[model samples]
Target: MQTENVTKYIVNWLKDYASNAKVNGFVVGVSGGIDSAVTSSLCAETGLKVLCIEMPIHQAASHVTRAHEHITQLKERYSNVSDTRVDLTPVFEEFKTEVSLEGKQATVDMALANTRARLRMTTLYYHAGLLGLLVAGTGNKVEDFGVGFYTKYGDGGVDLSPIADLMKSEVYAVGEYLRVPHSIMEAAPSDGLFGDARSDEDQIGASYPELEWAMQMQDEGKSLEDFEGRQKEAFKIYMDYNRRNQHKMIPIPICEIPNKFR
Candidate 1:
């Protein structure tokens, strides 16, 4: 679809969903990335009150800087846009110290990262409750479904996923169409979950375009041997991630009972 059409479609969907749910507006955690930028712009486009938040838990300076720029851009572009910055480092530290690894039965790095996501989720909900807004997620198709890259009950917990159907490349297209800041459009995509500021590709082992192509091939039931050289390597990485993260993609299973028995 054309970018204009895509933008209109998502905006309409947001409006309809909110109206039916009786929610006042949208709240999104801006990571200074294209996905969140596009999502925020779409929410702002709906003429509803939009709160762009930055909850940093030992977040890098560069990421926070970009976030401020993005929030400023949004405020300039849309009257409904407002911004807030809440440092989650102290909260995360307190929680970390209080909860021992022995008690949680989890590793330090992963548990901390997941805790960061959950902390942001908590901040979002806290603000949402105060303002009567629904949490708007920024996860795109590849990250949300293809690789299951988000933390369950963390970034995964959202009232609406406006861009979840669009792939990473498709999200860039929407960002361009919305005239999102060039810095964000060109910046390396990252979850900003780590202290060293690792890009998503650094962790995922492939670029968004590469993963997108692999996902397409996976959906088509095509063999990895369909391509040669580096493309095949990408496919292998995609498959590995896909296999390991399938649990995140699938819904929780439920038992069925007969109505007659009830």
Candidate 2:
């Protein structure tokens, strides 16, 4: 890919979209991950108001540090860029107190993890509404469509997704061109919703490169019978995630009323 050209294209696209929408600018949740770093940079490149928000809920120290570093660098590089931190830990705790925790341990833990993402989403939109800014999404192609790895109506809810068309590797390329902070580029990819250092690879059981390969294979219509050993295992993992999370990738289903009923 022509990294420079692609970066310009995305920046122009963002500028055009925001102009058409008549919004002041964009508000992005910076998670210190490659995607967010790249996204916020792209938004900044548009010379529009870019608000980088840090909403942490029991977040790991590394993630927080990287987020701060990136935001600081962004503000220094782009005059239109600014940042704010909203600690959501207490809010998360209060929410858990009011909800039922009677499910299986794993199930309850997963639900709470998703809750963290939803809380962050709410905070982002709150700022967006207050400032007349659009909520810019930080998701990439693999997480947004290939694996459906993000929380629905949580991080998945957004006013615009600037990098959803770029694959993970492509996103890294754009990040390199944008001069994203080195710490974020080197850190392992994570959702940071669980308040732990567990990488996205750990949760998905497949590294991005491996998943990218599997995604390509699936697109070519290859099946389990076509591979063996590790190849088969990786393919199966990709297929399982894709099938399970189809709801996130597709439009919400609606029950159509019969004309006669009306």
Candidate 3:
């Protein structure tokens, strides 16, 4: 696709929606990854007031560096862009420990990781509420829908999603067009949730390109056997993620028969 046009479309979309809402501006969580970097740039280009929040919850050193660098670049480029760093380590720890000590069910690793995302979500909304700005989301189509990789009610919660329609590859193309920092564009994708800093591939079981290809084929009504050999593995990973996380991708199921009477 024409990435230049895509960039313009996203920039204009942000501008239009923010104007229609008549809010203060946009609030984005800068995660120091390609998705967040690209989304931040697009929001800045809108020329509306933009707040780039670096909410680091026990993040890696490199994560801090990249987020700071990107925020610095944003400040240099846009007069409307504003930013602040909020460390959430203590908050996350307190919440987790307090729940366990109160005789509540023990929180598993996965549940705790999800809590981290929800914490970030709460922080973003807190700023947006006080500032009267919409929380601009950074999830792409692949991660948000294809594999349902995002944490539900956490990273998945947002007022608006600028890149939710674009696949992972398409997002990178738009990032290049927007002149996103080369280092960020080339960096390995991570959710920044784990203690060890695992890449997205390590967590998702397939590279983005692989997921994109498999998702494309599924959308096209093609069988996995069409791309036999090495691709079979990618397809399998895609199916596994989709099957396990399908609930996150769809709306909460309701009892239709009982509801119909209402």
**Candidate 2 residue lDDT tens string, 107-161:** 9999999999999999999999999999999999999999999999999999999
RMSD list, candidates in order = 2.2, 0.7, 2.6
lDDT (10s digit) by residue, model 3, range 1-262: 9888888888898889988999978999998899999888999988999999988888888878888888998999899999987889999988977775343343476778888899999999999999999999899999988999899989899999999999988888888887888888888999988755689998877899899999988889877677777798899889888889999988899866775687
Tens-digit lDDT track for model 1 on 120-216? 9999999999999999999999998888898998999999999999998889999999989888988999898886578999988999999999999
Instruction: For model 2, name the residue pairs that clash.
Output: none
Ranking by lDDT: 2, 1, 3
Please list the residue runs of candidate 3 whose C-alpha ends up more than 4 Å from where it truly belongs after superposition.
101-107, 224-227, 256-262
Return the TM-score for each candidate structure: 0.94, 0.99, 0.93
Better of 2 and 3 by TM-score: 2
